[model samples]
Target chain A: MDIKEFVAQSIGQWRSQRSAHHLAFGHFEAIRSEIAIEVVADHDPAVIELCKAHDIDPGSAVAPFRMRWEGQSDWDEEEEVKGTCILVPVPDPGQANRGKLLRDRGYAETMAAAGDYYLTADGTFVLTTAYDRAAAEEKIWFINPNVRCRVSLIKTSAGSGVVTASFSSEIRQEIRQEIRQAS
Target chain B: MDIKEFVAQSIGQWRSQRSAHHLAFGHFEAIRSEIAIEVVADHDPAVIELCKAHDIDPGSAVAPFRMRWEGQSDWDEEEEVKGTCILVPVPDPGQANRGKLLRDRGYAETMAAAGDYYLTADGTFVLTTAYDRAAAEEKIWFINPNVRCRVSLIKTSAGSGVVTASFSSEIRQEIRQEIRQAS
Candidate 1:
């Protein structure tokens, strides 16, 4: 499927199983969560706000999505946590598979971020983000229409150019409901 | 070139520049280092020791290589550090591009690790390791005979299945001698 088609199919409820690996400490943890993804109009208030937060023109945005995540991880087993984020995609005229991924609230940090994203020839969606002290590259691909997988790498810098912390993760995603249920 | 030939070509003194991103804290760091890689026979004493440490039969190993790294990162700028590791490749009967990667010292933790290694259809060498509390996946590919690039992800688990830390990195590699002489 094309890049736009792939993004369109991502709008739904999904169950995700994730395995996280810590590099410095040599540790592994598993996390199970659910996310609800909804498509929003380019001019939606949330989309507009996200663009404003990242200093991008709202008119330049092509597609916007709203995401809500709820789950329990190894670190937070007692409480179910929830988070909301807005993703705005700004096209790059120079490249078909490349664009800017603007986020109102970033994955690990709450600050807004503008990250680079591209779709591979094989249809894998890849994103790379650089924060003040951290950076991440994530790859997401569909095994089928109903199943998806993600692999990510994150690094935290200490002083000079040394890295004090790092982590790797693998995530599996499945549609929450089947065709019959949706119908 | 074939996988064996590729490994053979990796022997040399090379320089690497790495950028690390910390996911949770939103930090970024840079690292500069040099590595000297040498090929060792499968029956070498170091290879035998590595196999014994990991409970792998030495007879099954295909190639063994030694690596020495020296450099200064942002975290430790005062002193030049040196570290060494051994890499042993054991063939996987099931898959042509897949094999076992046995190491004397792992990337983050010091304990011996036997990671899964595979060559992608595009000729990228990928390695995935699982440790007691951490896990890592690394991808390395050559841009040419003297240039290469690497990407990696590491995750640290806190408890149960929760990940408390994560990092991602991108590295560029080049031949050391040619650049030095040019300068």
Candidate 2:
């Protein structure tokens, strides 16, 4: 517990509040790399062998990795696009200061809410925001991990009422998976 | 400013702190059927009539409506392959809320660094967190929107910064595109 008492007891301030609660919106350099290491420190086999320096399959990649080209058609211009997103998170010690204080007060009340929420991508943690990336990658390859969450939203559609969304859901923690890949 | 005093002084229960904020976390059948309104109204032409209910080209979907979603995925369980992201402001919005209270304690410290931050979409502000849909979308698009953050890496082999984690992050509204819908 040294590295300055684990950066004075929060390892780079809880890995920058769990990398600012998973890039708090989108594309913060694909997840990161200006070199700040110790991102929650996962199981620590040297942080899962330095997340293999960056293929990041913390078992089957999708715990706290994150990615998005934003389906580039000029994905709103982060230099027109190249590719980036790493964000590793595990070795929880104040879990990045409580995931950057619950996503900056839940993103300023959805920036005053009306018609903004609708992100898409899936291979884990449930999904279906739509545009149908092959039915959201076949529900991210049969995912269930006991109903934890990364993405799942409907938010008021109404033929019979719809408004869903999820994340860690206050520690019910079931999220199971088994995928293997190591060299 | 009527609707029950605009939900009493503009829906003042969201209590993360505010100076100019808005909200959305999901499971939003309009949050028990919309009532609160006015942390700054007029911006809600119903988010430009739901961007005219996605006719597309609202200048590239307004960068997914300004970005915010953190699903946290076990494949997202029944929520399913859920992923979403869009967080702008590497820096901006100032005076006194101190980067909106360090992005409101870094959005509950990125949902307690991805433990559980759920809702599953409704009127919108969707999340749940562990880091999948691109690290649950870097917990709001690469933090420090107030603070807490990760990723600095600078392209290595091709793996550079491998990513495929997703959960959820859907937020939009930073202004700048009103070219009357890019003309």
Candidate 3:
């Protein structure tokens, strides 16, 4: 599948259960979160700004979207995990399955980041991003239409040591809008 | 389950289908192989020698086994991928689910290597090894008694760049031995 189709299939609300291992600290943490992915208009301010920041033409953006997440982590029960990021995908003209993923908030860090992304033959989405202090590799695959799996690694800047590795299983929480007719 | 139990469950022949992406070259390769896992006796010479190489007591090794693989990669159809390796699992005395895994042949590099291994709450086995030129992260989990999944990453020594990332789906090829009484 191309990036647009992959993004379209992923548009929904999801209940995510994640387990993370901190190798440096030898700690295991559990997180439960709700994530929402919504499509963004190409002319949206966030999408336009993100494209400009990466020096990519706004017209080249395909299936731009915004993701918002809220969760609770066992590491610190008092602190809530919540954030949102705008993502814009620009497909390579030469390779249909490969492209750049521009993000307003990075996975390993909160800074703006652009990651290289590609789809495997089996339609698995793989993304890798390098940040100032760390790098992140993420893989996402669908087990079925409603269930998906994600694996992520946060490595040291040099990529020698992995500080954190995590696996998450997400189940889609489809929102069925109900219509009321005037009686 | 502990390391021993995990090893026991994995002792069998498997048909593995793997897809690997070499990020450096932006190439994708598919490999199909048959793998055999056989139990090794505690007194086996290879097990003893591997433990000694890692400076671990032979008696501490639990459920040692040898793995043999024969495969064909799409990248090189003429070159057959075939090899064998001895694996010795030495459980940590204090932690039941964590331990050291001594390997006769490393994943990223063909040299004797030791890796830290742990079983997650869901019984997924994760192993991380650091070799001279690269580091490897591997994760294996049983989807069912007859099916399993493996994910592996070979990264640069500094961990900044992922040279290769692979996903393998292994289906157990159970060997059923039959006994016939003398007629």
For this target, which candidate reaches the highest lDDT against the unseen true structure?
A: 3
| Interface DockQ of each model | 0.06, 0.03, 0.03
Off by over 4 Å in 1: A1-183, B157-183
Better of 2 and 3 by DockQ: 2
Q: Candidates 1 and 2: which is better by lDDT?
A: 1
**Model 3 lDDT tens row, A117-176:** 988766778898999989887878765565566877776688644556666656576421
Ranked by TM-score, the better of candidates 2 and 3 is 3
TM-scores (chain A) of the candidates: 0.82, 0.19, 0.92
Index of the highest-TM-score prediction: 3
Each candidate structure's TM-score, on Cα atoms with residue i matched to residue i, is 0.52, 0.19, 0.53
Write one digit per residue (lDDT tens) for candidate 1, span A31-90.
556778888898788888878877778987876888898877666689776799888888
Residues B1-183 of candidate 1 have per-residue lDDT tens digits of 445766887888776655454433323444567778888988899999888887788997876888998877565688776799889988786556678989988886888889998786557687878888887766675544665556655644322222222222222243333334443
**In model 3, which residue pairs have backbone atoms overlapping below 3 Å?**
A158-B158, A158-B160, A159-B158, A159-B159, A159-B160, A160-B158, A160-B159
Interface RMSD of each: 14.5, 16.0, 20.3
| Model 3's TM-score against the true structure | 0.53
